[model samples]
Target: MSDKRADSVAFVRETFIPEQPAPSTATGAVKWLQDNLFPTWANGLLTIVSLYVIYLIVTATTPWLVNGLWNTESLAACREVLDGATGACFSVLTERWNQLLFGFKYPPDQYWRPTLAFVLMFVALAPVLFFDLPRKLLIVTGLFPFVSYWLIWGGTIFTPVVALLGFVAGYFVYARFVKGSFAAGFFGGVAAAIVVWLIGGGFIPEGANDTALLQAVPSRDLGGFMLNMMLGITCVSLSVPLGIALALGRQSNLPLIKGMCVVFIEFIRGVPLITLLFVANVMLAYFFPPGSGVDLFLRVVIMITMFSAAYIAEVIRGGLAALPKGQYEAADSLGLDYPQAMRLIILPQALKISIPGIVNIAVGLFKDTTLVSIISLFDIIGMIRGPILASTDWNGVYWELFMFASVLFFVVCYGISQYSQWLERRLATDHR
Candidate 1:
């Protein structure tokens, strides 16, 4: 009966079947293409249409790119060389590349200074962006602002040295007083820094720049892609911390603090960035002492920082609100104070949630740095419109010039986007 039952069971394997590779049609590139591009008849048709469109675009652009004149001195020369062939006058980019990077007024001899500063910026940012790096590298990050300022602006070393000292003094004061009251410490730190600056101002000799190793370059001379990068980086850095404070303040139990934060965020958000920029360019001067003549770059930084902070505050507030009640309760149960709770627990989670929004704001803020061109600052676009195109050599090379600018902006924006995605993945601790 057992033998008959075994025969009826029909070939139960005595040994386990060996694992085999998936079929070529069910794996690898072929499978992926089939699943993604041609899973359905409709998708296959759409893919074919898309390919045709791409092919057409490539055909249209290939000749222009292939025949582009890079060595010609002028658009006319480029056209003569092309002799009515479909081609691009890309020589403008090669010729005016310096002016497109650093404004025409920046002394060509001193170009190495800004170039060095630009390179050091990456080194300074590495530790801050990638936390797995040695924490000691943060010292470089701390000194970078002053060092880069000295390098790019090229003045008496005393200028940045004094600035650094002022910050050091402010930090000490903040550290000393923070154990007592946060507000007192904050205000005390500011007052100390101001005092340090005032004291340091007297020590810098009036003829310092004349004797300095690197000749001073005034802020007005800063332009092109360099100016945009500086403004975008500096403002984004300043705004993030300020935005966090504003977000926290808005949620404060103190009505005064909350109201002030609310008003600032709402008012700033209500006003257009260009309007604020106009205020920076034209109106802000009236508020400063008549002889003070604060740098336009500084004014623009302040306005942009404030504008970006408002949006970031709203984003962070949303992030904070997204947290479950248990998170806050857990902090309270741990016997933590408000500041301690925020620093240790609440903020990390909230900031992780807020990363995407903050990155969006940052990318937008970087692009908006081009708007400074409208106010007569010669950012890359300003260089293109004002100097490059206005010149006889490149008068008609609009497409090439603008395309170069677009490429520059796209590279920076894409990098920021990629980094943000990596950061999000890194911070995603929840098991899937």
Candidate 2:
């Protein structure tokens, strides 16, 4: 009995009790380094190299960030202290921040106009980003431009009122009669836009009587970051839909239409955007009749739209191709016509798939708007360049100005990337 009890106790202890911890030297930080950093010969070599690189970066960066001579109060002070040494000049950034945010030409008292426009733009765009917004209210978002123009320009109310009426009438005619197809809606919208332009441009003799109002807001006075934003947004918004149509046309069964689309896309994609801008700036006049001079701003916008559209078409084509043939077959089996299949079934899925790619392209286009500097447009980057080169007080401020601009671009691009990621996650869930 005693022997049996002793045996049972031994078995119970062996089964229930935990083993003692391993030796300290073979675990914790040392074990982690062994397993992760030096798991193999190659890994050990890589680990050592990476650590050395990190050490070099840290040593190089610490002094510049914490103790560098870049923190002077003025340009002269900075030059005096640094004396041919290389470091960032952050003081210039502090002094010229206002000019960077709002162009140098913008009057200090009238800075409110751009600020207000910027705020309104964000408000109008909010609904687009947040899916919880009522879709029906999107019409108001589309009208935001007219509202913003009136607010910024402080024009006679009659002009904006007339434009708004024409727009509403156009929307109704297009939606009810034109049936929302691209061709009908486009032509109808164009007709409405023409009417608005006539009213704004004072084609009517009575409308022309508002000379004081027209004189109050001159075309030359309208060049700045606000102009850049307007041009970029309008061009992109118009181009994206056109691009969708072009992409679909390229993929269509009709040989003539497909061939034309292919030629256009290939031709535009082959040329550099700078060449297109130069053509708009120089060659567009030759295309028009002798006395009909197009606005430089309008020409630039046209060029940007065409360039962006071609690229967008390619991206959308990729999305369309990625879709399974089964999807097309399924749509046909459901008795839906080609247009119905595309609009209701195919495009939504395809566009969702291409959202991230499209946003990336958009960010690139936004950054490229800086190229307007080449054509004498006073965009933010262009404005910075002038002051950096011309100003006695701000000369040699390239590092500060470039750093600030980089941060601005980074923030905008990063936000766009994050939003795209969120959209991707949401769409993934919907697909599942």
Candidate 3:
């Protein structure tokens, strides 16, 4: 057969031609540029117009940024240096950098405390954010809230110690009761915590803060970016678990639980967050026992946590709803109880599905922390609009100061967004 075919063929090459490289337009940068930027006439025109607009923006802003005066003592000094030139007075950021970061009222000498806490935040978060890290590192994650609170608030060590004790007691109570009934465990845990706190409160000696190693810093003294970060982290941490509970309750078979969850979520979600902040600032105090003064910061935290949790519950509910009914049937077939099914089978998938929405709420909540300034809490924005801008030296440095704030927010929000995308990719189970 081979001989017949060879004879029938007119001619055959003894050797094949060497392989040739593809054309530039069909590969590499040129191909990418064509496919992405200029796939058609309309797209090419849009790309050209977009490039022109970008060029105009760059030309308009470059000189101002390039000529920025960083070393000057004041906006006036910066202007003097620039001599009526198109330049940014970045001296405001340079001069009040401490105030922008740690707040005007934060003790300069004790700045290391918050700074240390901030640095340690990464260590605590590392295990949770990157699960490949040693699981034992989660002990640090568990202790961070108490440790950070002590560092930043700087009260009697007994305060955090007692708080930790209360939680420990609550955990033991919950563990003891949970085997029989979840409700008993939950309410018993809460009651145990309250009892521990009440008993511990009496044990803390009066003026313990005065004799403490680190000086007490009142919540009123918390300001600037530190305050914003603290609020963002605290509210997000508290809200997520609360949100998960609410989401589950909303779907429960029990009418009382479902109705209450529905009412709470709807009421909180329908009202503007600003209104809640106002309530936290003013009306919330009235609810506390007469002269049993709750800290303004705590009130605000409660409000913010409640606000964020409602939105997150809705997001998680959507995720729960998205799951196939077959998943639930599979859980039943395995003879898993409701809690076991949710924990071991359902929640992990729902949470993965909810990641994007959860991250969105987190980012938005972080940014919304700036609203605390309106209640006189003096977050970073509050510092700018209050002290920094009002100061005689930096009065007119609007663009530079606001630009710095914008950059800080952008970096944080962008990081959250990127992490969410990474998490989504990592958790993706389906084949395209």
Give the best candidate by TM-score: 3
Query: Please, what are the lDDT tens digits per residue for candidate 3 over residues 1-432?
Result: 999998998876899999999998899999999999999999999999999999999999999999988898987788778888999988788889999999999999999999999999999999999999999999999899999999999978998888889989998998888665454466588789889988898899998998998999999999999998999999999899889878988897778878999999999999999999999999999987788678999999999999999999999999999889999999999998776788888899899989989999999999999999999999899999999888898887788888899999999999989988988888893425
Candidate 1 whole-model C-alpha lDDT, 0 to 1? 0.92
**What is the per-residue lDDT of model 2 for residues 1-432, given as tens digits with 9 covering 90 to 100?**
998888787433436566889887698998998889999999999999999999998888665545444346677887788786655567776666666776666566766766787788888887888878889768768878777766556546665667777777676665554443544454566687666655554433454436625223543455445665666677777788878878887887778778988999999999999888889888987875566556677688888988988999999998899888999999999998666788888898899888977887888887888887787777778877775558887676675577678887788778888988898887782454
- TM-scores for all candidates: the values are 0.93, 0.79, 0.95
User: How much lDDT does each candidate structure score?
Assistant: 0.92, 0.74, 0.90
Q: Clashing residue pairs, candidate 3?
A: none
Q: Which ten residues in a row have the lowest lDDT in candidate 1?
A: 178-187
> For all candidates, what are the clash counts?
0, 0, 0
The TM-score of predicted model 3 comes to 0.95
lDDT of 1 by residue, 252-315 (tens): 7778878999999999999999999999999998987678668899999999999999999999
What candidate 3 gets wrong by more than 4 Å, as runs, is 1-14, 179-188, 429-432
Candidate with better TM-score, 1 vs 3: 3
Could you tell which candidate, 1 or 2, scores higher by TM-score?
1
